[model samples]
Target: MWVVAQAPPETPVGPEFGKASPVGLFILVVLGVVILGIGYAFHRRLSRFNRRRLFAEQHGIDPFDREAIDAAMEEAGLRDLSRTSYL
Candidate 1:
């Protein structure tokens, strides 16, 4: 009885066997787009961080000093690119 209820081995047995649906393909494409977007955002944020760190280091300011960094960024006509608001 248990053998009778067991699944088929090595071969699929279904109505739409070996066929991929359009909806599944669409979900995969959407997931790819989402991953690309996240990667882009990460790269952008990292670039901004590097710029900010360089700026702070050049001017002898502490990298962790948010208030000073904000003031310097403002003085240089630069926006807070490291913030998620830019994304």
Candidate 2:
């Protein structure tokens, strides 16, 4: 009697597999945008803090004093536009 060897079946490639859908791509893009936005906000806050610290050092004031920093910024006319109203 003779025995025969059989080969394994190959996996079929289709649109549903091994491909990113439009909705998935959109979600990824949205997540990336959100992360970037958060990073930008953090950077802006850090820069503002640094600037306030430098200003405080220049004027011989405590950098951690919120009131002093605000007063210095206000006295220098360097207030953020978002906090001021022009009516």
Candidate 3:
């Protein structure tokens, strides 16, 4: 009786399949930076809007009116100053 010989299954090569390549990692990092930048910009815009809204409410003026905002700030002795002060 002749017996048939079976070949072993081939193993996958190359540092495991489905791993992220250098280019893919770079792309992901770039995407993350872009997303973060967009989020920061959105946060800054929202914060400014909210600040204006709150100021208007406190001063009983129209939030959309720039002249009213300026007048209110002047009346309240409020000035825009940089956070970092030089001595």
Best by lDDT: 1
Superposed by TM-score, candidate 1 places the C-alpha of residue 29 at a distance from the truth, in angstroms, of 0.2
Considering lDDT, which of the candidate structures 1 and 2 is the better prediction for this target? 1
Give the distance in Å from residue 32's predicted Cα in candidate 2 to where it truly belongs. 0.9
- Residue 10's lDDT in candidate 3: 80
Q: In candidate 1, what are the lDDT values of residues 1-87, reduced to their tens digit?
A: 355566667777789899998999999999999999999988887898889999999888999898999899889888776765744
For candidate 1, what is the lDDT? 0.86
Candidate 1: segments with Cα more than 4 A from true spot: 1-10, 13-15
Give the candidate order by descending TM-score: 1, 2, 3
- In model 2, where do residues sit more than 4 Å from their true spots? 1-15, 80-87
lDDT of each: 0.86, 0.78, 0.74
Clashes of each: 0, 0, 0
lDDT of 1 at 75: 91
* Stretch of 10 with least lDDT, candidate 3: 78-87
Any residue pairs clashing in model 1, and if so which? none
Candidate 3's displacement at residue 41, Å, is: 1.4
